[model samples]
Target: MQGVDTVLNVLGSVCLLLWGVRMVRTGLTRAFGATLRRAISACARNRFTAFAGGVGLTGILQSSTATALLLASFASRGLIPLSIALAVMLGANVGTTLTAQVLSFNLGWVSPFMIAVGVIAFLSNSSDKARHLGRVAIGLGLMLLSLHLLEAAAAPLRASPAFVAVLSGLQDEYVLAVVFAAAATWFVHSSLSSVLLVMSFASSGIIEPKLGLALIIGANIGGAIAPYFDQSTTDVDARRVPLGNLITRVVIGAGLLCFLGPIHHWLAFIDPAPARLLVNFHTAFSLVAAIVFLPLNDPLAALCRRLVPSRPQADDPGRPRHLDPNVLDTPAEALACAMRETLNLGDKVADMLRQTMDALENNDARAVKAIEAADDAVDHLYEAIKLYLVQTSRNELGEEDGRRYVEILTFTTNLEHVGDIIDKNLMELATKKIKNRYSFSAEGTAELRAFHARVLENLRLALNVFTTRDITLARRLVAEKTSMREAEMHAGDSHFARLREGRPESIETSSIHMDVIRDLKRINGHLTTVAYPILEAAGELAETRLKPSDQTLMRAPAGS
Candidate 1:
């Protein structure tokens, strides 16, 4: 019964530690995701900068796995080259060791104060950003407290014969010890947490220093494998990144295994305490990896590419390409996938609109036919996006993530409306114009073409606003809509004036010209709807674009 109690207590402490680590990673990610993404991307132009970027970002995020995914996402999207992404992963490995170093310190005295301050801040903060920071602090405090509990749990076990025998068995089969550590890491889904657990055990003499070192190596190698398997079905570019990073870890792990005796002896001489020795060795190995592997990024990337060659996109419309069902477990990642699909839908709408404009400008029947086909594709994509989002909506989502999901849905819906106008309304108008051999007057044609150009430009802007959620860009898009409306109205008056002059071409095409202009204007209206959701969310919108409908406001005073 006593043995069972010890096992339960140790398990509880480890679980607590893992939970604390998760809370910290998530809280930090939510608080600084945008800034970190921007910073990492900005520094991805060259190998050196990319390496530095990875180090800085992972240090702040405290999770190499998080940084790895970010690199993979960027590479998959063509935002960064594969080589630079590999370099970033190398640096990220080093950055993660910083947390292990911090955890190994004797900071039990600070845990209570951290918990108190974190709780107060978490309870007091009303703003979302502040609330996120508070959560980070709380997570940190819990982690420290968990370490304290871990120490207590292990201390009693150090005097147990059964515990000594287990250690003896593990020490005899270091390979088994490494496998056990790897399994534990995969379970926690965090290498840093796993290494810290090993460090705690080492400090209490529950595990030999050499065994602890083996476990840390296993933890690092296991961390790399987790991502590789997670991205098995992702794009070649994404999978390549984790594959490259995993190769680096495995290579280093193998080389370290050959020299483990010398390395352990060297580190032991420096640190008398088992906990400090384990953490120090982890940090040292990571530094060596960064130093040794940074120079080989390009070659490693090439190897990764060869290993996971990019294949042609599968011909499956029913399958959602960007919407990975597995990522729905993580709301932020799920939102990102949905957003990409939304942008893809926007691209289809843009294509249809482009063809519709060309069909009108050059009077091409084939372009009109193409617009119909493209619209069908757009509708199919919209259906896929809607269905995929529905599946992910069942998952638990944070407030901000839920809002982002709705924004994607709204954006995709507007794109569908735009596509409908181009295919159904404008396509029909183009067909009639071509069948009747009607041509606009010179001035009317130029005015219509210029207006069409501006509308196309605004569609591009709307898509950008959706992707960036940039309030400034969103405002510009809204403002451009007003300009587009004015242009539509002016083009109409210009057409009417040409008709009044009885120009032969204008008179022959009067109905087609007016109808085409109206259709394009309606398309503009749908595009403008994209900006309203963004502005309203920012509290920069009014109740209505007109005066209040209240009866009291309409009534004149009796004195007047």
Candidate 2:
């Protein structure tokens, strides 16, 4: 009965520890995700900088698994190269050990104060970033408290003869010990928690220091496994970083496991406390692995690529390329995926619009068919992005992420509207012109062509505005909406003048010409909608564009 209670308590403590680690990782990701992504990407120009970036980021994030998953997201999207990503993983491994080193110390005294402060800040602060930081502090406090509880829960087991015998058996079976720890860490999805658990057991004398060292090695190796399996994409590029990082850990961990006897003897001279010895060994092993592996990243990356060769996939522009399901838990990353997919949606619509002018001017039936067929792809991409954004919204999002989610959803919806206009309205007009072999006046053709060009440029700008959310670019995009309206009107007046001059081409194609310009203006209106959210967010948008009247009519009596 006592043993059962002990087991339950230990399990609960372990669960708390894992939850705390997750909270910290998620809070930091929510508050600083884009900045973290930009920082890592900026370092991609050089291997050393990339390595440093990984170390710093993982140190702040405190989870190599989190770092590994993030890099995998980037690699799958082709945002970061495989070799640079490998370098970052190496640094991340070292960074996580830094966390273990800090947690290994007795910091239980600070836990309550941190938790109180965190709770107060979380409840009091209105700013999203501050609230996230409070969550981080609370997570940290929970971690420290869990460590203390784990030690107490585990202390009782040290006195049990059966438990002692089981731990004693592991001292000789080093391979089993390492394998067990590796499996536990992999299952937990956190090496920090595993290492801390091992530290707690070693401090309680439930396991020999030498055995704890082997367990820590296994934990590090297992840390790499979760990310390798967590990648949602089948793209060979996306899987390379985690696989390469895993191989690196396995290689280093296997070698270290074999030399555990000598490593333990050497580390005993530094600090012989069982817990400290295991912690020191974990730190040293991570540092040594980073030093040895950093320079070999290129060759190692090549090896990973060779191991996981890219399978040829048919290029389907309609398919969602970057909506990786693995990142959906991280709203910032998931939003990025949706944004990329949305941009692809925009590209498809732009292609359709660009082809309309050529098809109408040449009376090319095949081009019109092609444009019509391409709209199906546009619809597919739009639906994919819309669904992806909906899934991302299910997660807890900060203000910034929530707004970006809406921005992405709104822009993709608008892109779909633009696609429909190009397909249903404009394509129908083209078919009519083509079937009748009608041609516009030379001047009218030039005018419509020029108008199409302007709309095309605005399409590009809208996409840029969606991506950058730059206020200046967004303002310009809105301004172009007015320009397009004026151009449509000008084209209308000019077509009427051509009819007055007795131009036969104008007389025959006047309706189609006017309809085409009207549809272009409609498309422009949809594209300009992308800029509205951006301007509104910055407080640059007016509630309505209507001017106030100088006089108002009185309301009539109800019946009258």
Candidate 3:
């Protein structure tokens, strides 16, 4: 009966420890979210920078899984290369050791204070960022307190005959200890949690220092397995980082086991205290592994490529798409990919619009036919992106990502609208030419072609802004729209002037010229609709263009 009670108590303490660690990690991620993004971006540019970024972020978040997952997300999106990702993963292993250091200290009394402050901040009407920070502090405090409880629970087991016997058996059989440690880490889904438990046993004298060190090493290796498996279905490039992480740990673990004697001797010199000695050894092992593996990142990446060779039709459009539903687990990253696809849709639509316009002006029925077919392709892309966004919204997303999703949906919808407008409006004009037997004069055709060129330029610029989110390009779009409006006004005035000059042949041509000018102006208006939303989403839209002129320069040609 006493043994059952002890088991239950240990289970409860472990649960609290896991919960506390989750809370702390979540809070820290929320508090420094922007900085984390910036760090990721900065690290992507260079291998060394990426390693530093991974270490710093994992140190702040206190979770290697989170860092590993983030790296996978970046690689899947093509934001960072596989070599840099491997470096980052190596650094993350070192960073996760910080949690063990924190748990080793006697800080149980600080738990209540952390809870109080965190709860108050969480419940307060303060900024969301502040509340997030408070939650992190509280979680850290609780984790420390749980460690204290775990130590106390194990303290009783230390003097028990059965418990001592179990510990002695684990110590003598290194293989059993390694297996036990791996199972504990896998079961808890956190290396830090497993390490804390092992550290508690060590501090209470339930396990020898050597066995504890071995278990800690095994836990690190085990914890890495989950992330690697999780990343298996991601991009081929992304799989390399987790694969490298797994290999590094396995190699290091094997080396440590073979040289267990020297490892213990080296630890004794650093710290004679058993618990501290174990912690120091754990830290040292990770740091050394990071340094040793850092230089081999490129070769590791190459090996992963050879092992998980890219398929023959990997980049083929018809190949089974690689966009996994699991990616939606990270909403921000999912939205970014969605946006990229949306931009692709925009480009297709723009091309269709240009081709349709050319077909109309040049009287090429085949181009009109091509435009109609392209519209169907745009429809397909729209459906895919819309479905993706719907799935993304179901996940827990950050505020920025949520808004970006909304913006992308809006932009895609507007692009679709532009496609519809081009196909329908230009087709109507084509019908007019066939039905009324109306053929523009040479002068009218020339003017219409000039107007078509201007409108197509605007469409291209709008698509560019969506693709790159280039503020400079967005501003240029606004400027072009302004210039287009002025050109339309000048053309209208000039046509009126020519009408009164007593040239009867000029009358029919002038009306067609005016129609072409109006259509061009209206196309630019829709293009602006696409541009402004992207600029606004980027928070780069100028204040002057916030409330864009509702008075479009093109009216509906006075009801046909």
Candidate 4:
């Protein structure tokens, strides 16, 4: 029963460690994720800078896997070269080792103090950034506390005969130790936790330093596994970063195993303490990896490219290009992707609008069919953006991100409505006009085409508003609503004037002309809604068009 209790306590400590790491990671990601991404991207001009950036970022983030996943998303989108991404991964590996080195020290005294301070700060702060920082503090405290608890949990097991026997067996088999550590790290999805556990065992005299070193190597290899699989995509470029990272770790790790005996002997001379020896070896191995592999990023990337050849892109226009699923955890990047896909959706709708004039005036059957096909494409993209945004919202989001999320969803919904207007309403009018052999007067035709062109222009403007959120551009887009209405009214009056002149073409096509004008105006209305969110956000929009005094009802003046 004691043995079982000890084992359970050990497992519990490990779980706590994992949870602490998670809180820290999520806190940093939520707070400074966009800045970190931009920092990484800005360093893409050179490999060495990119390497440094990755090291610094992962040191702060405390998760190389997170760094790897972020770089993979960028690589997949062709924002950075595959070679540069590989360099970052090498640096990220070193960064994790740096974290382990810090945690290896006996800062157990600081754990409780940090926890108390963190709790106070988190609960008292209303600022989002302050709260996020507090969350980071709490996570760090928990991590340190978990380490102390883990050491205590392992103390009871050190005296157990069965535990000693298991340690003895592992000590005899270097390969088995590596494999065991690797599997354990992979299962937990955190190499830091695995390394800390190994450190605890070494510190407790439950495992020798040589065995601990082997286990660290395994942990290194295991660290790259989760990110590689998590970045699974049809694009080979995206897969290359993680795969290159894995290959580098495996090859370098296996090669180092042959020298493990000599390395352990050399480390013992510097400091014979088991825990320090393991921690130093882990740090040394990572630094050596970065030194050896940083220069070879280009060659390694080329090798991976050959291993995972790029597949041909799918022919479907409806398939989303920018909505990378891997970035959903990072809401800023995910929202950026959603924004781009929304623009893509807007482009499809614009194409449909552009084709409407040809169908309406020239009676072009092919143009009508193309517009219909374009609407179908718009629908597909709209659905894809909507679903992707839904997934993004599942992650914790800041106020700005939340607002942008709504803007994207609202804009896409409006674009979808615009497509429906083109497909169902305008196309139906075009079909009827063609079948009935209706032709508008010369003036009426010019006015209809001019109005169509103006609406198309507004569609482009709405997309610009969505993309930039420029107040000036948004205000212009909203103002066009009035111009469009007046144009519709003017066209109506002109049609009647032509009717009074007894123009045969106007009389024949009068219903279709009026319907066409109304449908174009309706499409314009949909496009115009994209501006309202932006204006309202800036407090430039009034609640209603009526004056404040207009709210009061006037009594009938002594009604007769």
Q: How far is 84's C-alpha from truth in model 1 (Å)?
A: 3.0
Which residue pairs in model 4 clash with each other? Answer: none
Cα lDDT tens digits, model 3, 1-560, are: 88787888888899998998888777666566556867888877677787787778888878887778777767766878888888888788888887677667777788889889888887884576777778787888778888888887777787689878887888878867887887778777798888888878878878878888889888988888878887776667667767878888888887888777788888889777777777877787788888888898889888878988776543332112323454564466567778778767877876886686566566677887888778777777788888888987885566667767777888788787877777777666765564555666555566667777887888778777766767788888888888988888877776676677755545755554576577668778877765676567668765763543445535435654
All candidates' lDDT scores? 0.81, 0.88, 0.76, 0.88
Per-residue alpha-carbon lDDT of candidate 4 for residues 278-333, written as tens digits (9 for 90 to 100): 98888887888888888888899889989998778668888888897756767888
Off by over 4 Å in 3: 1-8, 40-51, 76-81, 153-169, 314-340, 346-560
Model 2 global lDDT (CA atoms, 0 to 1): 0.88
Worst 10 residues of 3 by lDDT: 314-323
Residue-level lDDT of model 2, residues 1-560, one tens digit each, is 99999999999999999988988987888788878879999988878898888889999999998888888878887889899999999889888888888888889999999899889989999987788889999999999999999999998998899988888889889889989988988899998999999999999988888889889988998899888887645577878889999998889888898888899899999999998899898888878888888889889998998999988889887888878775676687888888888887888888888899878899888888888789989888888888888888887788888888888888888888888998899889989998898988899999999999999999999899988889999999999988888888888999999999999999999999999999989989998998888888789998887765544223444564
Residue 309 lDDT in candidate 1: 86
Please, what is the TM-score per model?
0.69, 0.77, 0.65, 0.86
* Best-first order by lDDT: 2, 4, 1, 3
Candidate 1, pairs of clashing residues: none
- Find the candidate with the highest TM-score and give its number: 4
Q: Lowest summed lDDT over 10 consecutive residues: which window, candidate 1? A: 317-326
